[model samples]
Target chain A: MIQISRLPYYGRQMLNWGVTIASVIVCALILPSRLPGMELLGIGPNWLLIWVVAWSVKRSVLQGAIAGLALGLIQDGMTSLHPSHTLSLMCVGILTASLKKQRYVQEDFISVALIVFGMTVVAETVLALQFSLVGDRSLAEIWTDHQQIALSSAILSSLWAPILYYPLNLWWEKMNWIENNA
Target chain B: MDTLRRWWDRNWLQVALIGLVISTAWVARQTQGGSLFEVYQLLTRPFQSNPSKQELLTNAKVVEMEAKLQQVEKENQKLRELLGYVAKNQQQAIAAPIVGRGADHWWQQITLGRGSNDGIKEDFVVTAPGGLVGRVSSVTAHTSRVMLISDPSSRVGVMINRSRFMGVMRGKSGNKAVMQFFERVPDVRRGDVVTTSSASELFPSGLPVGRVESVNLSQSPAPEAVIALSAPTSVLEWVAVYPVEKNTDSETSQANSK
Candidate 1:
């Protein structure tokens, strides 16, 4: 196979885009599946939320929000549109980006997982708030349900964050190095 | 003007990419992610449960019970025909494998391998061996999404089969759903069978939903009962999809009801 490093700058950029888009597609595909250990109480990890968190960390606030919005719309397409997923994901992206992890935390699995855990709860809460605003479902029920969802989603997404984060982070870091050197 | 020009020139590629991505996602949302699901269906086709393995899993006892149930159903049909009762037109059901579960934690949904290619349409009734599963929420060319009766947003008009007490049942996000009765003191008891009532415009009446687990008669707004859904939604492998017989009355009622 031809070495990616030897390719022209434009070709390298195109490859970076290809890798990023492929990761998003993979996350989307994995969202609907319940692979044995990945599920808890019939709930799976919030893959899209994890993806948003991953993409948002180390990116600008605007870039993070855009990533969130795009993924959220895709999620809405996968599920119902009334209580849209966009708001929650957008919030996650914005929050993650604004955290400025370089100031306080180091680039490690534990910290990244912690951020994902916190973001998962935030995302679920935002969704619950949207459900409340819709008024179709009872407020009591929404919050009560939110507790279980947030807890499980946080746990699962946190535990699984590194699986998605490590590779994507590596690729983006390499791309950044290549761009700076070129 | 020079600074603005420089910024635009520098960020033009990023701006174009972001716009393209957002517009693509917008198109996906408008089409209910039909293309994505089609790709998902294609990718998952190899992993779908095999029919032969499913057959092996069904033991002889369940088959015997199914045979007996069929006999009783046939007899009940004859009796209803003898009494001149208007028989419901039985539509042929298409069997589909459960290819996926809900994409998110909030919704209780299932993705079936069959779709419009198999004549399944939106709002079609989906049933499993145990009872009513859900209704088809959206359909792609080769895949369809079902909004399960267990979804929190789903509300079904149901009645106690034993007492004929009408109520609206709303899913509580799992196997259990809470039913609020129309009457102040409905004569509902534990273990009573609940089925879709005639007032439900979205579903055919008399389809089995679940059994009442408990009743709280003195509760606040209205009397409520917790129902354990008969369909094993979480573990469902295969389901039957039947076209809903749409009428002008139902359409008007669906609009007026909710």
Candidate 2:
């Protein structure tokens, strides 16, 4: 909220990177919590996935992929190795970035929420495919699980997407404006 | 050559910066996000309350159950002693506060506040008041990540306590687990108790897991029953992590026995 444009170019750039890193950290720390209303059934909202989607909505393809890779690996650290999260997240990143939201979407919150809901289903599908390919569990079992997780995760993530998307969207817009006007 | 040099000069910092970010993320992944949990432990320190103060909340039913279990255990110990069966040492447990939930939904996991600094290690079995919760999968300096028994990938050798019908228990998301009996028509019924068998490599023998909620004997390949986890995996606030002392021979045999 402070006057970013008043600062020197190097300082502004440093502050921008700081904000980005801090946001990622916030998302990571909240990944394991089941706070009051943040959970549905036994599942909490996918914070990192939400962050990646918010990041890639306005970025280039390359940038989105990179963000996805980093967040995915961190998520892998938190979970297990097989059926890696990298593929699902990377796919989400590229898809969201390629949408190039500024031109297509009209309403901010609703569109972001819609994108988040769809992306959650896609991400879960990618995970299910990985599990199936690994040949660990029966195909029937995997799909049945896929249906429940995808629906619940999609509903929860989209409902909570605005909480993360709004603040991050505001910050990015402010920084970009400062870069143009300063 | 001059153009190449100019490009490198313009982009060297960006390349190096991105490389740094990426390499750091990779290291964090390799270490199981050690640094992140350390920070989480620090941030949540103020919110954790004393566990002993909850004695007042222990209802009469639980107290009565505890007394009955203690009596049974005492009789079992005396019988084992008379039979000359060598008993394994009961290792002490380290109580840790649950700081986080699974990073992602696909895998059911929890993060504990105690880690290596407190002598916690990977593969330590965690338990809540009702029964077995899960086992530690990764450990950092001040935090450890536990793979809950409710994860689909988690399969533990279990037996129906009433009938001793051996089978494998598979975790479903949430607190439900599906147990497949080894015999075609096992003597399992609704509301039967399930416990970890002597064959589970990742957990100790005879740990209370959950109760049978429903039974499906007609499933192809094997009979399956749904178990309602008693540890409250969906609402766990704290757990006790016990160190595993049995060495390679015992662990390998149990692993292969499955």
Candidate 3:
């Protein structure tokens, strides 16, 4: 039989994995919903971006990029495929992971929100760049629209990021603590 | 060999988990998230509006309109018969509740609670009480996604009912749209009713779209008019799906020639 000490460690690892995956599922489910007060200018919070930020804040760049890629693909399925969202989301994940916030900013909701806000802007800019390159939409119109969308998305996503990030982070942190103690 | 084994032992679980997740997400994307939408449809089934109550109350009103419509249709049919014209039959429509909005803001779309099970299909025209809403772009087993008329990429051939001026309507990100006239000096004015023209291949003629809000006749290569969409797109609760004639333009041209 497995030793009692190792049992808790394995259990905690499993629990952490479960929580992480559950959060991703929640984000995917919420993508299509436009519940009251969840909208601004016909836009909703970037749930996938928030998930990426949460995942990357405590992980490595490769892990963050992978999370972004996975979530981006799901989002593309929910939306349209062209001008792929994978690039923008992967950039967000990589940038957030490379921030190494634990060194400069404390591990807290405020910091997480700040990171998400910046990352949202970055992601939107990446998308705008792609749109500009595609040349389907006029540059002036694209940039003007980008300005409005980026500001609104960033503000809303940052404010709402903690609502998802807190519980998820708490669960992950608890599981990590349990594993370490075990 | 020992170093390689150590590396594999340390990273194998993580690699496997990542691979599993990436592949699952990829599969979901490839299938256009049909499974996800099916689950969404199931979860939202209870909340789907029951037509029984509303239908009963609206039955009298609808019957009165139907009677008037029948009278007009009969007159039209008689006129067509006199002219030896082959009258086209109207397709049946299915009513569905608006379950959700677009997954992302960039694309203007809506999720309807009805799908293949209810005979909904891609390219079906969707309209609400006020006017034309959109067209079904994709469908899953029990739910369908609609591309709203207000999407930037969606262009429809429209005409002013009063002046018979023809133009193409393009979405302007919200309830408003911009209509570009084919004629430089087209007769158009504010408050003119816009409808799908017979020239449109995607949509059937005479479906109300919106009313012109303003006109900018001198604005470049094409005269532009801003239109206020008839349907309250942001607050749409329910919509009706009509099976569109796949080649409506060709059929109309054939009728005209005959």
Candidate 4:
């Protein structure tokens, strides 16, 4: 916002990275809190999942996978480690990025929300699968939990996708324009 | 070699950034996100629960304490006659604000503002006004994470206070848990109070856990009961933490009996 176009090339790059990293940190911090309007059934929106969908929607598959891996590791730290979050998030990243490549959906708020809804289900299912394979819990219990979690998370994440997507999309668009013009 | 050098020049920064991010995340995972919780605690310090809520919690605490006193008194009379047992002095409790809930919905956990700095350590028992909440799982300098009894993986040795029937309780998500009894035809009924038994090594004995919601005696090899946890795990504003009294002799005796 502060005349990013007027900055030196390296300065602009630094600002871009800073904003990107800061947004991820904000998502991480919000992951554990349940604010008044952001909660449903004691579950909050999956901010990291939404962020992964947002990032992967416009990036290469490799980049998306990397973002997923990093965020998933951080999420594992915040939660437990036995059923790692990396595989599920990485699956989300790759699926979303490839969905973009196949030209299945256009770029818009609704489309992004739809992608997030589907991807949240995908991510949660992957986690449930991991839990099943871990064999510490009953298969029926895991799937039952999967149903509740996936539905609520998909609904909340899709509904709130715009709040995160619009801003990040705008910032990336502005950064792209400035870089191309320079 | 010329083309490779050109490619390196074009993308060295991106590669380096990716490496840095991955390594940072890996380090965070290894430390179990201790530094992240520390920062979260600092940021949310200003937005803690209000004085009005604290007052409500205090009033609830008083009623719960009286109920707990009545239960303990009844249990004490029975135990003294059966085993000639003597009660030990209780340590002072450290009260802490509930800072956050579980990071993921799948895990039922809570982060407390007070930590090792305030004498809270791993496995320290946490209780709210109504009853047992959980135990401290990990601790940073000023923050500690408590794994709520509602998590699927948490297993606690519990018993019905009325009949002295022993069972193993596992979380069923939300504010409910499933307790499986050792004896197939154990004496249990709806509305029976459940508390921690001496068989549990992770928590102290006799802490109130929940109340029996229903009993399912014919379902399986071991009779099971559904317990509705007394602690309002979803809306807890504050909790009291006490150090676990090491009862090695009791633990060994319980193990021998098993």
Q: Per-residue lDDT tens digits of candidate 2, residues B112-138? A: 889999999888989998899988999
Clashing pairs in 3: none
Candidate 3 - CAPRI tier?
medium
Q: For candidate 3, what's the TM-score of chain A, rounded to 2 decimals?
A: 0.90
Query: Which regions of candidate 1 are displaced past 4 Å?
Result: B246-258
lDDT: worst 10-residue window of model 1 chain B: B245-254
List, residue by residue over B1-258, the lDDT tens digit for candidate 4. 999999999989888889999999999888888998999999999998754768764676687888998999878877875886655666999989999999998889999999888999999989987789998999999999999998899999998999999999999888999999999799998999999987778878888999999999996878999999999988778899999986655856878999
Ten residues in a row with the worst lDDT in model 3 chain A? A1-10
Query: What residue runs in model 4 are displaced by over 4 Å at the alpha carbon?
Result: B50-53, B56-87, B248-258
Query: Would you list the rank order by DockQ, best first?
Result: 4, 1, 2, 3
Kindly report, for each predicted structure in the order presented, the TM-score of its chain A compared with the true chain A.
0.98, 0.96, 0.90, 0.96
Best by DockQ: 4
Task: Say which prediction, candidate 1 or candidate 3, comes out ahead on DockQ.
Answer: 1
Q: Write the per-residue lDDT of candidate 4 for residues A113-177, one digit (tens) a residue.
A: 99999999999999998998888777888888899999988999999999999999899988999
Interface DockQ per candidate = 0.83, 0.73, 0.71, 0.84
Considering summed lDDT, which 10 consecutive residues are worst modelled in model 2 chain B? B244-253
- Where does candidate 3 chain B have its weakest 10-residue lDDT segment? B51-60
RMSD of 4: 2.9
Candidate with the greatest lDDT versus the true structure? 1
